[model samples]
Target: MTDHALQSPPSAPVRFPPGLIFACLALLGVLFLPLPETLPVAGQRMLAILAFAVVVWVTEAVSYEASAIMITALMAVLMGTAPTLADPAQTYGSSAGLSMALAGFASPALALVVGALFIAAAMTHTGLDKRIALVTLTKVGASTRRVLLGAMLVIVLLSLVVPSATARSACVVPIMMGVIAAFGVPLRSNIAAGLMIIVAQGTSVWNVGIQTAAAQNLLTVGFMDKMLGERVSWIDWLIAGAPWAVIMSLVLVALVLKLLPPESDNVPGGMDGVTRSLAALGPMTAAQKRLGGVSLVLLLAWATEGRLHPFDTTTTTYAGLVTLLLPRFGVMTWKDVQARIPWGTVIVFGVGISLGSALLSTHAGQWLGAQVVEHTGLDTLGTLGVFAILSAFLIVIHLGFASATALTSALLPILIAVLQTLPGDFSRVGMSMMLGFAVSFGFILPINAPQNMVCLGTETFTPRQFARVGLWVSAIGYVLLLVFASTYWSWLGWM
Candidate 1:
């Protein structure tokens, strides 16, 4: 491989994007718009800030962390109608401002994400991720088709523990590159394209099946529990979402294989190279075994939290992290954990939660919900019709949002508000799951998700190829999920 090919995609130099200027002007327009006096002052301010934040996030005018920080500052200043000197009992928005701007930092959901990151770090430090990938890959033997299945299986299993799609991709991609190299597959060959696409898509596809598979999934659960008072357990999410997750994962494998077949059907030396790589790693280390045990126990605790009612998910995750950091029983050090976990992700979630809470507090969801339903004529549709239409709309909406968490955090409140207007008993949990999972299905572009970007970075596949194949995959996935939502979820009393 060329030196340049091995390096990450080059970063562009700092320059002002025209989109940022437009976003600023748009925010000013919203702030100064002359409207009737019926709208709550707090709601208007919250809505304007939400619109501003959305534009800034979608346009990539600034880093996500910077946007989040700016959001915190704006919430405190713009949303507050009273002076700081005012007493709490006398002030209208002072307490609201403080709570809305800083509530996310105190959220248990944020704590869960932090703890989950430590678990991921332990997996990396102990090389458990590599061992799992190798063992799964070697079991499938040397046939190209089998190897592809093996790769998909590894990503699915890894999702149960790794939680982050990008982290799972990071672990699986290196193993795939080793397999491709061992077989002497050309860097630009069809085999390389198939392998790379599956690794990226597989990790994303399975993210919905497991509750802890992605940070956004956890955030959705938290939103439901905290905002709606509908606690969606891990087992509940798995029961409702796993069917589609499995189906879509297999669909991706078949789609990529048909779209980009390997150069040859079989590896020259069969599973020999893959097996040799696994053998080279020697037996599982004591640390790997220990981490595995801790992960398994943690997974069980989350899965049973709904029925057993033990410590909450966040508490369980933190307890596990503490176990991992113990001097003798633990597998990782605090310093190593700090280096491995992305602290910025915690910041993003904290700010996002704070903002979502502000919207709910100011009744922004109810106001915007009424407007969307009225403007879009959603109230006129039948139950299943609403599902299909909204499902399609949500799937396409992914084009405008950059991060899955941002997309969910921005739109979910509105969705909840809209559902409340419906005549029948609608499942907030059901709709929330649909919206959260749909954002991750941003197949039209590489910027949709980190895993897609990781795959594109390999340079074996182009955006054109991904779009051509992804367009149909995304369409089919949307339809398939809607069908299940209408038929299966309805029978189960979820709709």
Candidate 2:
């Protein structure tokens, strides 16, 4: 089958049965009854309804923002917060709830994603991604193991420039596909293992090193700011999370090397073919240079945000302005940059944030916290352990969730409440759980993450193949979280 045939359509034009959607939402209303009597009826009902809407929406491509709007409207009306159509419309517009929903759009992290997309588009336009792939493959010179290692390194380096995992995967997948075809590598064989491992590992590695590397990191920061009135600094995040990322990446690479050693001495279509294909693509264009320069300025702003005044600009505001002005400045056309922004993602983040704020403001998270604490029957270490395990389990389960922003927004507040009840050091435990939830267990399925979906498109690895490695990797990652929290966190005085 051709690529189009193999791929699923992006959206379904036919509306799903309203009865089904309402039935699910109504069932959720029932589930909220036992949540805790301490939760206000309005708050409990809102949570149940939002959660139900999000679940249904995930199974469709109904444009996340539209779904968010529907949820906001439904809540405003059903809860009698508005009491009339005009009231609900006005309430929706004036809502602190809506402002929180739009928070992700105003985040520095989203700017980075937008910047990265333009950069990736420019690189693709300039044939840079293809050129890099060819050069790296040639240097490896028929050594299968070295090629796999090179691919992982290339991806790791690319992460600094390509902020979105999906974009990075898209940029690399075609190159890998061509390489496999050229080499006559069996799609189901060891080579597939190496390709899958590198993509999965690379995605996870970047998720750790920077705030803008993944949407989840930004969501965590946003939610934390709303709940705790504090945000993690980039340097602090790198210091705390990078070591684990490095260790995990290395472990994944080593496992791939051992499990899929190169079997052939043949160069696969030879270096000449690869060079010719790359050469056909030509050098960087003017648009690429402009995009690169704009992106660099944005990165510098983020890195020195706290230290430098920069005319008293906030990083997100700076980026948004630049993104808005770049086209007028003739750096890149608005068409180019606008298409690059993941608006659906922004909406998902906003809606999640709105719901999370409601949960906190109404004391729903606190109510849930009391129930969990009472039932777990644990204190101190037991409580911390319970939180860690719960965080780990949630991370794994969230693999099925498409929106990282939505998942984090909905769950982090509850997790934070659970952590707040812990003894000794609260921030240390909270931060550790946050990191674990942000990075671990996303490799289990393609739908688990954007990068995973990107890798899946290669047709080199099946879902079963991914699960084989993912199961072990996830288990190891959780254990590492426990170890890192118990030892390193105390050493850093974060706990």
Clash numbers, per candidate: 0, 1
The superposed Cα distance between candidate 1 and the true structure at residue 493, in angstroms, equals 1.8
**Candidate models: Cα lDDT each:** 0.81, 0.62
- Evaluate model 2: give its TM-score: 0.81
Q: Write the per-residue lDDT of candidate 1 for residues 29-92, one digit (tens) a residue.
A: 8778874354566677778888888888889888888888888878887776732323434445
lDDT of 2: 0.62
Q: How well is each residue in 351-465 modelled by candidate 2, as lDDT tens digits?
A: 6666666667656677776667677753435534664767676766577566565566657777777666655545733463355445445767667777787777667777876
Off by over 4 Å in 2: 1-28, 31-37, 57-66, 79-141, 265-274, 293-300, 308-330, 382-387, 428-433, 436-440
Residue 318 displacement in candidate 2 (angstroms): 3.5
lDDT of 1: 0.81
Stretch of 10 with least lDDT, candidate 1: 82-91
